[model samples]
Target: MTPPLEITPLPYHEDPLGYFAVLRDRPGAVLLDSGRPTAPGGRYDILSCDPLALLEVDGAGRVHGDPALAGLSPFAAQQALLDRLSREVPESDLPFLGGLIGYWSYDLGQRLEPVAGQARPAVTLPASRVGLYDWALIQDHDRRESWLVGSAARRDEVLAWLSAAARPAEAFRLTAPFAAELSREEYLARFHAVQAYIRAGDCYQINLAQRFSAPYAGDLWAAYRRLRKATPTPYAGYQAWTGPEGERAILSLSPERFLECRDGRVETRPIKGTRPRGATPTEDRRLAAELEASLKDRAENVMITDLLRNDLGRVCRPGSVRVPTLCGLESYANVHHLVSVITGELAADKRPMDLLAAAFPGGSITGAPKVRAMQIIDELEPSRRSAYCGSLGYVDVRGRMDTSIAIRSVVAEAGRLHLWGGGGLVADSKGDEEYAETLDKIRHLMNALATPTNDDKWNKKDLHLVDRDIDIQ
Candidate 1:
């Protein structure tokens, strides 16, 4: 039998990030921040620690590393985790009394390859992972309310810890400078190669990427704080955990939602088109309009949308999948995007893991004809996309789930900080313009990682730069 969970309200009203700063130093801590405050009535920010169990699946079926994740493929591992959660948590109660939280790396898709001849880089991360939390903090910003959630057995201990953690603490900080893996000339040459594949009918589109890395000498929480402030988005999140190698942290400020399942309905918001925000209102509006009207961008978006529809159809009921919205313009802190919403009714027997297995990596980031595009990506991009292009979020006890595309994210490991930036490539895509677009996407992230002055305090004001919106059409 499972124990009943308890939710005790806390009176602390300070910013959740501050509390998160204190928690990040702890083992198995996970924080999911929507970044900016939500509307009058919105979901609370989540903080959790002390997972009851940790589940990981290696998509490549490699047993040489990480003995725990021995023989399972990505999909098989996801299903196993879901089954374990069901057995541990009663079916009548909420499934998320504390559920799994982690990421699904892009390489996890290797297991789904339909063809055998395609070459791919060696797998770096497990196919899927979820940490089952026994303790959590939910902060409701609109109401200025917070709650401490945990199993009944740990109530008193959790309360005492929360009380002590509520006290004031110094802000976190990181001092690291980043260097790109690709030179401008090298990136342009690769971009042209992707274009050549597109022209050859090998693939209609492919997402090309470049990685940037820097040495770090400070708290990761402070770095995440700067990232949130610089590029606030609806799907920002922070996760810290110990692994076979050691401690690992992921800071994601993604603006895209990969998959969300609630009440038996599943939906995905794929972002395909991007235009940098303009300096003035008039210029911003013009850029938005141009993005909507761009033939190439729209075609690229539709291709991915079609791919997603097919992916969803595999697990969804027959004729239940539909596109509710198509190519709507959405503006964020640094850029404007063309987003499309696709929804479907899950099959009666399908679980969240089933949905993920069918669509582990979102179509928007991978490009059209996902598997083929991924093979081409491996051939062109120099390094593996460890956490970038992955999915991060939670799966609740009720079976409700929400995950981000893991773009605009940073990974801290081995005393170094890593970030990636890229965009979709089509036959008409220009190498130079595509290269410039990657720069636009990463400008704010680069600024956030710039060296701080003598006081070790970041000058948030100076980080905001004038928008130099470009036309990629």
Candidate 2:
């Protein structure tokens, strides 16, 4: 049987990411940061590592575990993990104190194909994955409160580890020079192709994207710090792990929340329309106003919102799905977007993963009439999305969950960083304009890469500690 977990309060008030940096090198470490400051002068940051078990779906659409789980379809495999974990840990009053924390890749959708005849691009990364961590550091920035949560047997050890990690650490260096996988001309051509599909009535809208990569030879933590500073969003995260394939890191500065389920109520915030931030305050207000007034943009946002509502309806109580907010404008660091919120109450028998399966590859990123749009995406895009457009967050033992749309994210593996940027295309979309919008979306990430790092920022001289093993109680 799984041991009972415990939570112990701490008095530290330093930057959560800085504390996370000390543990980032540990396998299965995950940092979920609400980048912007939260109410009462605090933000929420969760740092966890050393998963008790890991649930992963491989590139070939195979689940890694018991025969029963592996034999089930990929989406079913994910749901099984959630079900088993909840049964093992039971519900907790603390939201994320002890639960599964990880990500779901975009390619996991392949398992849900209604028919077997469709072709799909190959994915280079694990298709769908989640990790069940035994220990975590939960920080509430507003209240200046922090807690080390773990099994009761290991409380003393966990507290000691946290106190040690509170000390400063050495800084690492990183230099990345990025190159776009698709040239401007090539991206424009693809945009036109998506428009052709829309014109053909294959779909009214589709989200098209391009990939960019840079060779890196240094510290990923340092780079992530710079990224968070450059583009602070409500949903920012960093994940590090070492598997059979080697070490991998994912850094995300996403502004969109794909799903949030609490107390059996599910909510999705889909972002469909985007406009670049203006050079001046007046220009910014004008751009936001223009976006609010654009019929085309509003229509696009509504379409995705409706799509999400339908998705929620599948696992939610019948007639419970509703659109509470429609086409609201939300401005971020680099862009202003048209967003809509959809809410529903999960059916009595449904699990969190049921809601995830019904809405995989979020509607905002896929376009209207999701399945058809996805097929077209496979045909038009040269490669698989992998982690892009996927969801990353935590599913608590209580079954409460929250995940962000993995846009404006970077995947780091084998000393290379991969990034993607894209936009939704409607029948009236212009190829050049859409391509430019893609550039605007990735501007902050690119800037973070270009900005040089300073060694002095780490203040490593003060850290006189060595790494110690964290013993779970």
Candidate 3:
């Protein structure tokens, strides 16, 4: 029977990107955005579009679209094609009425562990790319309301394609200017080889990154609406598929919440300390009170919140995880973090792809013993992190889920675009302040896409935007 889904009630645009700019050229479009038009963060804004299957996985883990998941694996072929799809629970609490939304590639955790051929695969795309969506459109923006769940003939065929009209794309420029594929003595010889593996103890925390590409053409949805108006986050996303290197796009503007779950309760927040907002407001409250009184950023946010409370105690339940917020702080739009939170419960014989295969690519960006800090970030990052720090949101078939640690992301394929920044490096980390804190976490997203060259000395200073106060707790 699979019918049930009809929720209805429309009109709410508090900026759900104008109903995903009319199903963004259909075929598996996604949105998941929550920057509520430019801050105050997420309440719900999940869009969708034609997707009755489109799985993709490669990078040797194989599995590409059905064939009954050609021998599983890519989180068991997304838990066996979302358990053979066709669930119908819509009384509405809205959190993805649809099922699998996309992205997972932080090189899809090298097909779960053993770090495979450690690094430099330089984006061929697809380590994960989902999309099952039976239909969705949920926009709440804290009760300004909007629904449109499904059948009623797919809600009058997505409300006559969201009442047509809206179309303006084409302005996204930047045909070159980003640069930096490590060189400042190759990122200080990979930050002293991660401070010589944290002085031989081998790993205490190791995120470290840097990569900034460029060479774009037009409309990656107008550069994700100019990076969601400069940096409004709350686990932002914007997927777009068709890979094998052509027309790919990810765009995420994440603010770090890597897992949520809901109902069976599960949470995670991580974000291990940073600081680059300060351009006054009394130096942004002295850089959010010096990242809430840094004891080395509260020991790198308590060693990645005790390594995500031991990866959510493996599948949660017994003593059900914990950590309720450590190293708090938040504040975004060009930096100031330290977040933490943890929580758990799931286990009654687990699922949510067993907590996404026991927490995929996150421990605040793979540090503190996450498969040996992802094999020292694939032996010191220099390409390959296809969807930077991976995991974009959605899992719902009423089991609910949420994601986003694709850190201030941006991918866009073939015509180039890339972008990544990074952190977490203990052992008194300071190789010129962790290489100017990885160019101060993406230097205002490379100063919003362009400007710099003339031997671009990392845009010779000048990047500001911080009216602060977005706690994202």
Candidate 4:
């Protein structure tokens, strides 16, 4: 009998900024999903509530948070970084995701000059064909093909910092505004292009999106109350937190899952398909049941699940793979979705980097086969997806980690903002209704982005999925 996969067991030491500082020095990748040095001593802890850490990675499509190697933002630096991160998606073919500023801006159309002396890469040059399996980067500690810091020195330093980091604040302050949006015309044009591009590429599926607004500026607590009362989602919650510099928000809601790594195991739950909740309980159940029974939807769920399972397989012990469930219907405040759970035990030898390497650019966000799907997304979407598909989570000094898929999330640039929302398109998807579904995803964000709506001009942008309708005139 074959011996079960014996992961030689990896020996790891911790540091708050240990190996990360080294990663910062490497070329061409945006650091998404930054791990924070928690309070009480700057201990390594997850800061999923940090608005800044929520920013995503666009590195080679392995979307991790670009750790905040710098300071805070006063404006819409969100989408700007995402666009920068989006550049990484294309380079996976070149097998590189680097050269980033990871900065956000407030004035629309602001541009960042490349750092002096940085190599200006030629676009669309030298293409090589590495064997399918050959192109994947193998991430072993010695292969330390990337940054690999050594010793337990970094771990000890973090505990010391955490011990020193305590102070109480009266209340939080906003360095800048969070709610923002884009114009209707620009959104429509972009959506139209996405529709055309996806079809031209013969993409079996693509998720297209747009932005909306009518910012409801109230206190974070008040906003939380309204959002929860006005709209409820399974993934939505109110989290209150203060960072090193001090800022906080209600964080109204989030409907995606990133990554969850515990004792000796790791798992990623990808959410693929979605439907709106109903007024009546009977209607709600039917919606969930229909999603479960949906052939097109279930197929979409399976494709991502298979892709995730494959990713987990790379970092897990042999025979440790299992899909405990599939196409399970999960309902949320604004939407109902089909979720699949895939789990595995990590090879004692595997590192956090190994887990991420096996599953960069989550399967749920990108379609399958993942590579081709990403290529299609590049061609379909209007701009680079800086953080939309990346992840946000916390990693401790001990290497325990948890991350969420960046979905139902917004990225800002200047006061002009960019956010995306879309559903899986299958053979049965309608041309126009799919467009409406994207709008549904944008509904809450729109309300949050623009000025409060006592004015008569504000109209609820209702989309009719059945008739393939959009109510944006």
- The RMSD (Cα, Å) of candidate 4 is 14.5
lDDT, candidate 4, residue 276?
79
**Any idea what lDDT model 1 has?**
0.73
| Model 2 Cα shift for residue 471 (angstroms) | 44
lDDT of 3 by residue, 52-87 (tens): 888888889888778878788888788777766676
lDDT of 4 by residue, 1-473 (tens): 11111111123323212322222222221222211211111122111110213442122212233444223221123323323322112211111111111221111101111112121111111110000000111122222222212113322333333345333212221222322232444445655654565567645555544333221222343443343344433233223333342322223234565566776677778887777777899998888888778888888788788888888988899889888978777666567878888889989997554575457667777666665656555544434454455554433323455555656554322222334566666556664666667766656654544324444243333211112212221
Candidate that beats the other on TM-score, 3 or 4, i.e. the better one = 4
* Number of clashing pairs per prediction, in order: 3, 3, 0, 45
TM-score of every candidate: 0.87, 0.88, 0.36, 0.55
Q: What is the C-alpha lDDT profile of model 2 across 179-201, one tens digit per residue? A: 66667777777888887888888
Best by TM-score: 2
Candidate 2 TM-score, C-alpha based: 0.88
- Ordered list by lDDT, greatest first: 3, 2, 1, 4
Ranked by lDDT, the better of candidates 1 and 4 is 1
